[model samples]
Target chain A: MNKLLRAGFSRLGRSCVFWLLTSFSAALAIFMCAVCFKNMNAHGDAVDAGQLMLNYSTLTGVVTAIFASIYIGVDYSDGTVRNKIASGHRRFDIYLSNLTVTTAAGLFSYVVFIITVAAVGIPLFGSIIMPLPRLFALLGCIFAAASAYSGIFTFITMSASSRTVSAALSLLCALALIMAALTCLGVLEQEKEILSGSVTDGESGEVEFVYSPNPRYPTESERKLYKTLLDINPAGQMLQLAGRAEPDFKLIPLCALSEFVAFTALGAFIFRRKDLR
Target chain B: MEYVLETNKLTKMYKHSAALSGLTMHVPKGSIYGFVGRNGAGKTTLIRIVCGLQSPTSGDYTLFGRSGGDRAIVRSRRRVGAVVETPSVYRDMTARENLRQQYRILGLPTFDGIDEILRLVGLEDTGKKKARNFSLGMRQRLGIAVALCGDPDLLLLDEPTNGLDPQGIVDIRELILRLNRERSTTVLVSSHILDELSKLATHYGFIDDGRIVREMSAEELDAECRKCARVEVTDAKALARTLDSMGIEYRILSDTTADVFAKINVSQLSSALSSSGCELLTVTERDESLESFYISLVGGGRHE
Candidate 1:
């Protein structure tokens, strides 16, 4: 088990995929920060550091999807898994190694992005609007989301034998998670309007008023379902955390951790029975 | 005999056909056991089952001493090195890197013998050459090098020389011989190249129709494959009387037939038998080669 972990981490840290992902993600955050700095100068509007960080965290999902497909797919295409098993390593260990390495890489990349953003933004934009404690809590949720992303994508990459299909499925999955989060964000952006009444157009002695409940506001059940969606989807968690809106969203981090555990366990179980060919 | 591998009625079935049906065979310790069979005759299927690439549908096998389904079988497999259909290798990695990864998988404290194993397989000079860029022969040698990393007690090679040139074949044959003699590693090599295996195998197991038809030592196969004559007569007792008098070695296959293992005058034998009130019914010259013997055992080649 130690050897598996050591070798897995060694490959994970050294592979081109790891470097490409880390650089891409860190570069994306810096680019987004630069846009905000420019916006502050041109429009004389204060930049929201927390919102900038939240908006760019979506790159974590994109970066993980790209890296996980290529990195894990290489094992099947090259037949190295056979080398491990034929050398007496269990299948469960192989799956766990992949999961651990991917999660580590994602976390490491997220840290790089955070540090880069903080180095530039703290001086340019002044202190962040969200309190330091809540900010840290949000960052913790993002880290947990990275873990969940690793588990979910690793399962897809390992299950499908074809690298092309695995990669396509991974990209599609990542895109779908972000799309779901974006939909939730769009829904929340609208202020719910209830008991609406409009009256008095005084142009031609027109005096009329109408009142009704707002259709856009989600109902109690809809609110619960939407929150559940945000809680389970790692990308949604990242968005929520980056926005600094989840102080009471305590269950979000737990959901992310559980997603990691559940997906890893399920992937390992299926892989154990799969024929290597 | 002390057997390193023993299978009891081992069977494996696909959805539409049986790959190994009630097949049982053995590999004695310290011998190069040649696994001879046609394609689709369960040679690779059996190799996969024993190597843990696939499971048996019925029956079980024992490796070293532990049987299948035993927790110790995984530990027991640590003593086995195998090259199943294709060489299981990381194509993008260099040869040395590939071996190092294998060393890590085996959990060796250090990459102590990587250099030695590479040198043993004649890949010492493949400096920084990724396996994908290697020649077919080089990749094969690298595969064998990977298998030899753990200094395993049993080596299972499936078509080790499948795509090699003549020189490559000789190199692999010599390497197998050396490994067996120097290390006493039991080898179960499956190949359709009977001529090469004939030179390397100390023992032979001929499988056909997914079951073993015969198992014999080299000496036994040599005796069985020798030049001989098939003879039939009206009275075997009289024919044996004449052949024994003439000091010819023979096996009485049936009441009216015998295979005589000597050159003789047909007329003289006929006259001798007739004088003893026996009639010579037929005399056919016979010489059975190994290929012919295998075909005879399997009934015909490439038939469903």
Candidate 2:
């Protein structure tokens, strides 16, 4: 409904959380840019924007989670949700409006951060490595990841009544998931170290060197499982997308987009059944 | 009678208790219907359900002409507004900002009525002051202002004057009366203060144990609680016979006492009683108030 959108957008525009997160993200982006510029000035070789973006997985994921959680949580704490429902707006419309606004805000702040970083990083670190279409695909992946994060955080906000608890839990859970995904990626990236086992000297039948293979490297099936976790987890997809892996349409992007759909639907469904009292 | 709201066997059950059990009542159009009940008696639950904040477990209700599950019911709800339990406002925002948020949500083309509603609720001067800093009465008035947006045909106020001083109570009372009398807006107000409701309600529904124990117009309630003469005599048998000959509506209380509904010449009754060999001991006029009437229905011993 138009009324729902108007109300939701107004709230989003005036939300302190939106402004705070935007500032935080802008500061982070600026800090990264300054560090890159300093590195280029001192070493004559600027930091790679690709590596800088890779770290955005944890940064953007956690920040968006905090933003979305606190944004929706205030509506519940302030009892404004009842106003919309009492005004004859459908529950689905209210939920959808919040989702749309939070997603849009998330995307907007992310773009601001991207532009701020690009303003410095492109000139110093060099232009984006990929072609135009490929860059667009990567941008799409980031947007999808941001939407999924919004859905998840919104779901948590609607499920819990206490704003403080919802925000803390959302932040903690998002970070925990990112850590889990990072650990899985770390395991996948472990290389098998060559260990000489039992080398015998040709002249004397004496064992000169003894070595064995490092078992810390993931097996093929274990590697598949870790890859699946990385693909399915929003934070993991964010990390993988940031890494600029051959942007095939199959894994990380699909996971992020599907999660966006799934979490939004699930959040809307739960909110519809929620009682304001 | 044209009813603005009607419920059929509405029941709401909590995990361990039933807040409302088979509550079926009607609010006639163009009347200030008072919903009287003690705490935990389903007053707020009924309001919440009708306002779409919660769902009735196993019942249906109709607003205007639309049933609960019908798509048109939403349109019907556009004609209704309610403040359930507490004022739903953003505490950090100023009063004007709060109303502006509500106005935008109500989809009014312009902010035309925002100032008008603020003036109507006596909050026009609450400029730049956040609702959290306003007094309780100011917040209450703001809540009513929010409900008054869109000029709804029916308004529901739940304990609108719960924590107000005498002047605040009078302000809210006068506001409700002015809205009803000037606008013909049907109001369903729930409150524990019977005397306060008595001054405002045109119709009364006495709810106890989650049921409507009585529903009547003000005139009917007045007649039931009207002043009457109480006469104590030596023998009610002879007094009844004497009053029957005089043709007065009366209720016999005991063998030696009776309540006489009509005014009578005490001297004539004394002379008639003496002729019947009965002594007239005393005569007193009495009228039960709304509080006593509610006690009679819900029992005088139980406390809210």
Candidate 3:
């Protein structure tokens, strides 16, 4: 057990540089969010601070996912995975050690981002802070997102032939997920429909404008569809939290937790069966 | 005496191709067992199986009388160190750091004997020098140092002298000899360099196409490789009669040439031949080298 822990710690220690860089980037993003919030307040604009914070957090999540891919991907690219196995480490231990290091780094980066956001928000927003339980719940959602993303990215890293391919695929997957979520929410449906019509007509056609008043709540069927989609789409829950007038801490975090478990288990299963060579 | 390592019809197949096909061998305790085979002859596969890096597909091996499938096989393997194909060392770490990491993996209590191991592999002075910057020979030495970490009694080295210079080869050769002679470490050394193996091997197992073609002791190999005098005589029958009378071992090669195993006085041999109605034409002494003997044993094209 001590040997296992020592091995885990050694792997974690080697990735300290990644943690440092992540913290620095999170700090920069938090600073930018503060400046954006301050500029909007100074202009007396009714800006959604929560949404801005969510965007900033999402950016950090994306960057952390990329970092995880590179960190674990390098060993696979360099034939070190085979070497470690040859040195008598069990496959489970190798996967678990890498997972532990990635988790620690992700949590470290998330904590740094959370602290910076809180430190900036309390001063500028006049201490109108979210409740501690709610904040912890929100951070739990963020941690789940990070863990699930890292797990999926770890699988990608192991399966990829090169670091470049792994990084590209990770970025592509993250972008595809975000874009798919936006498309599913009907944000791009009208524009897409118009483009399809134009291509069918063999000419560039103009889209007609249709104005509708903002509804106070979604229809029952639409709400049911959103819940069903959230169950399958982990990122959708983050969007739902960002779009809500009041944070639905219970629903969003529960969905995130389940997705986290599912993806992590899937990743572990895929990694355990892979041949090191 | 119990064999330190034994394979019972071990076979391994990769997908549709068979890498090892029923290879059976035995290495006696405290003996320098030379594993001789050509390139791609399942030497590394066999070593990997014994080292627990791989599993045999259709057979079993026993280490220290413990079968590979038994629970005690791991304990038996704990006493074995191997350098298969290439020396496994972290190029980013220093020699000491590499050893330390290996010690950690092995769960050793402390770094007590690390210094002595370094000195044993001639890397004692490589302080603070990372393996990446070390010369190939130094890296190879560091690999041996890592293998020595657990103080294993059985050492498996596969093609240790593959890429070494003459001096580097000699250095590794001397190190292996000293370890076996002084520490009584049983070594299973695989090499294509038959001449070099002949210098160190107490016993030999010749593998060809993933099968053991022969196994012999040093004395037996020497007896098989005896030196003889090749003599050309005008009358082969007369020369044979003379050799029969003198009780000398000789084989007739052709109408004019024959080989005699026993040494003889040149003048007396000529006089005997003359008296026997045969004229001595030419004589040349020849001794078989290990390489030639191996080539003859396995056949020439097979070695190629």
Q: How far is candidate 2 from the true structure (C-alpha RMSD, Å)?
A: 3.5
Model 3 docking category: incorrect
| Segments in model 3 whose C-alpha atoms lie over 4 Å from true places | A37-41, A44-88, A119-128, A158-179, A185-230, A233-277, B230-262, B266-285, B302-304
Candidate 1 residue lDDT tens string, B100-164 = 88887788889998888988899999898889999998989888899998899999999999989
Worst 10 residues of 1 chain B by lDDT: B295-304
Of candidates 3 and 2, the better by lDDT: 2
lDDT of 3 by residue, A202-247 (tens): 3656554544443434566766675566534545555554553244
Kindly list the per-residue Cα lDDT of model 3 for residues B80-128, writing each as its tens digit: 8777676777666788887887787777889899999899888989888
TM-score of chain B of each: 0.92, 0.88, 0.86
Give each model a TM-score.
Answer: 0.91, 0.91, 0.77
Tens digits of per-residue lDDT for model 2, B4-62: 99999998888768888899999999999999988878899999888888888888899
CA lDDT of each prediction against the hidden true structure: 0.85, 0.84, 0.73
Lowest lDDT sum, 10 consecutive residues, model 3 chain A, at A188-197
Candidate 1 off by > 4 Å: A48-56, A120-129, A188-190, A194-212, A244-248, B241-247, B267-279, B301-304
- Please write out the lDDT profile of model 1 over residues A12-86, one tens digit for every residue: 765888898788767877887888889889999888676565565667888888888888888877767766777
DockQ of each candidate relative to the true complex: 0.63, 0.70, 0.21
- Model 2 residue A44 CA deviation in Å: 2.8
